[model samples]
Target: MNDSREQYTLANGRTSINALPKVSLHDHLDGGLRPATILELADSIGFEVPASDAASLGEWFEDSADSGSLVDYLATFDITVGVMQTTEGLTRVAREFVQDLAADGVVYGEVRWAPEQHVAKGLTLDQTVEAVQQGIEQGIDDARGEGKTLRVGQLVTAMRHADRGLEIAELAVRHRERGVVGFDIAGAELGFPAGNQRAAFDYLAQNFLPVTVHAGEADGLDSIRGALFDGRALRLGHGVRLAEDIRIESSDDENTFVSIGGLAQWVKDREIALELSPSSNLQTGAIAAWGDDLQDHPFDLLYQLGFTVTVNTDNRLMSNTSLSRELSLLSDAFGYDLEDFEVFQLNAANASFLPLDERQDLADTIIAGFQSA
Candidate 1:
């Protein structure tokens, strides 16, 4: 169940995917907790878990999430989030989260989680953010001690179903100098449009804080439009459904003619990054409109048509996946090579919430790593 330790390679088996430097843009903090940690934390708090052992717990997560619905997939978080209601729980989870990312060859990552969800134990929003930051710093040092370069930032998220959007936005901006990098709104993406949180988006915009919205996953084109026009998202979380705007006019043996809708055209022209998680998309039924298999994913179509598509493991524990495993699955599905893998990593690096100079530095590091490989 420890997917980070697994080795992955390109379709030709000439290069190792795990050896390359990578950037993760859409990883969820609460969704990536280790099963053993959950067990110990839950025991300390006298909370009940679905499984007694680590292996069974891991399997249960994967199996439950495979129900092919976003709501059903997210229901598994009740256990993981239940254990993260204390300072020790939050810090330890965040620390191990980074360690796991480093072990998976992630040079840089942005961990997203809702602060309000973790304050159930009477911790203030600021306290929750501080605890997670403490863990992130510790995790960075831990990875450094292991001789792996790692940098992580928190994306303080507000549950879309809640009325604390503006409060969470301020919390994110309040901790910008610490470990927080950006802001996000995630939850049920169907009824909760980004427009409902317009006040928070306006606040973030005025403060010049970057944003990424969980859109185009459980909903269609209008949801994406609201994310762009209202939330002012610098990136789209699981923007897989944006493919709906594209009309496949015709296709032949070698040529596939297509027409892009105005919205898709704007997104393409603006180069908005699509934080696409292949496994999570399938597990959440986000890509069910296209097909049931990985090959049915529109990632290749988006990439070939020049959309800014980035690979991510939206929820590693839920999907029983890692960045390397996701890349390997995509390679298997579409004959991708090391060069294509490098492109995906570079795309993620550029789309990250880091400053432009640091993003370029990350891009250079990725290039150097790929060249060495």
Candidate 2:
């Protein structure tokens, strides 16, 4: 029940994963609320919680998310979202969200959230965005006050199942200078294809907003194709299912032959980063085809094949994980050393939506951080 991440050390005791500077590309805002905060906020709003205490509530989220049912997993958000219906709630949650990421050693993080979902208490979309920005800035200053420095950007997201895609897209573009860095679509990726939000995608594309689609997770190749072709996604969220297009023809003692389809070829060639969340993938059954364990993940395969794969914690509260813990798990399963961890960090840095010069600077930060470690 205690899913809090402990300090993770590599097989070699020389370096600690917790001490590394990392970039988190695909973390969600509503999905990362602290349990104790959730309890207090729910009380303020007179909403009932499933558990009486923070630890019990945290365990409930982790347990329900691991049920391997998207329906059950999504049901947990009803509680978190319930608490975030006010400016105070949103600011507190967003501020604490950054503090949590900074504490986990995240140097830069792009936190995504669907603003439309948080307007149930009569908050306009713009008000919600401002409230969250306020919290983010406060959290950054708070982290610095404690001698930790972190930068955060907002990725305004539209729910794939909702009809306000275009509205959300405009809101994101409006806030481009106010911490919003990118746009995304998340929620039921199966029937609600990215094509359903084509108008929004087209709007963002014409406006030159960077986009990342929640593809190749709940659906297969066609869904991924829609994300790239229609959604114009600069990156793929939880692209673990992109493996469906790859066919392993043969395996021998000395060699293994595999063939890739055109889509996979394009993704690899374009260097579009795959925001892969190993623990969350298993919890949601996203990687069930390969097997039900971390070892069965296609991360190493993708890495070896030269695809831009960056690690992430899709939902820290539900998955009960941190960025350091995710890296540590990958290291344990793949026998990765510090240099390999550096490569992963560098991969995330290069794939981030920062301006080219800034992205390069992030890469340099990772390099310098790793060198010192």
Candidate 3:
């Protein structure tokens, strides 16, 4: 919506990363709404927005989110969730979300959102899921008509601080056959540990549902440990701070020695994916311990250590980013080549919540796209 065509190019002028196939595993449905769409939806619902014009509204979201305070950053979601309280609003936003992903060359995307946050307009949970499914189907059809094939699935989320985890987990399982692919716990990751939702995780585990928890972003190793042990999270949402587990023992001009703590070792040995969002990590202070620059991110260390690291745009609207822009920024910060970019996409494909066969298909798609490029 913000001329992403101009924003998503390789740093070294290698190629247009936007044209490469990608997998989006940690994106947020509520956080990816277009500014114009938000304005229209808010107007129809008589909701107040912080800004009147589309551009100003977009800037407001970025600025609010960039305030470096988690509470301040999360306030931007109030306006988005306010507008997305109806079936019509949810459907339109979901449809455009898919279209935007397709336009950005995302072969597959998992749109995560807290359904509990969207119940203000009195729509039942089932109705909200169905509305989003309808929009996803429409988006797929639209992409097919335009000779672009893209697939999207919903990752139903339960707010971590809320008491609806068990209900939301059941809702995800009930709709798994329709459009839902996975479960996640989001919102205020500091004091709200995943252990509080033990019943939900237990239910999901019994039902064989995959989960990715938002940990290690606003918290530390204890939170990540809870996500793995209590939530049984197959992946970590913005688990960038897991780098804290690694201690740089020594460094030289040629190489640096590091010691991986047990937590980092287990994550690596198990091949659990870290859904690292470059821009959002910076905006949310997830990488504050490392440094205040993109180059300071531990993405390189994690990648070099064979962590199953994957790139994502956690909140495209809030961060004013896309998957392509994320890859581009990583390349600029770390001097990564096309092969490195391909590996990130492949890692994402392998880590997708899709079944094994579909994951294989996604990997093949990424290989073909990269080969062509």
Q: What is the lDDT of residue 287 in candidate 3?
A: 90
Best by lDDT: 1
lDDT of 2 by residue, 219-304 (tens): 88999999999999999998999998888765567576889889999999999999999998998888889999999999998988
Q: Quote each prediction's TM-score.
A: 0.98, 0.97, 0.97
Instruction: List pairs with backbone clashes in candidate 1.
Output: none
Error of 2 at 338 (Å): 1.1
Worst 10 residues of 2 by lDDT: 1-10
Tens digit per residue, CA lDDT, model 1, 1-373: 9578799888668788888899999999999988899899999999999999999999999999999899999999999999999999999999999999998999999999999999899999999999999999999999899999979999999999999999999999999999899999999999999999999999999999999999999999999999999999989999999999998865567676799999999999998999999999999999999999999999999999999999999999999999999999998899888888889989989999999999999999999999999
> Better model by TM-score, 1 or 3?
1
- The clash count of every prediction, one per candidate, is 0, 0, 0
What residue pairs are clashing in model 2? none
- Ranking the candidates on lDDT from highest down gives 1, 3, 2
**Residue 154 accuracy (lDDT) in model 3:** 94
TM-score-based ranking: 1, 2, 3
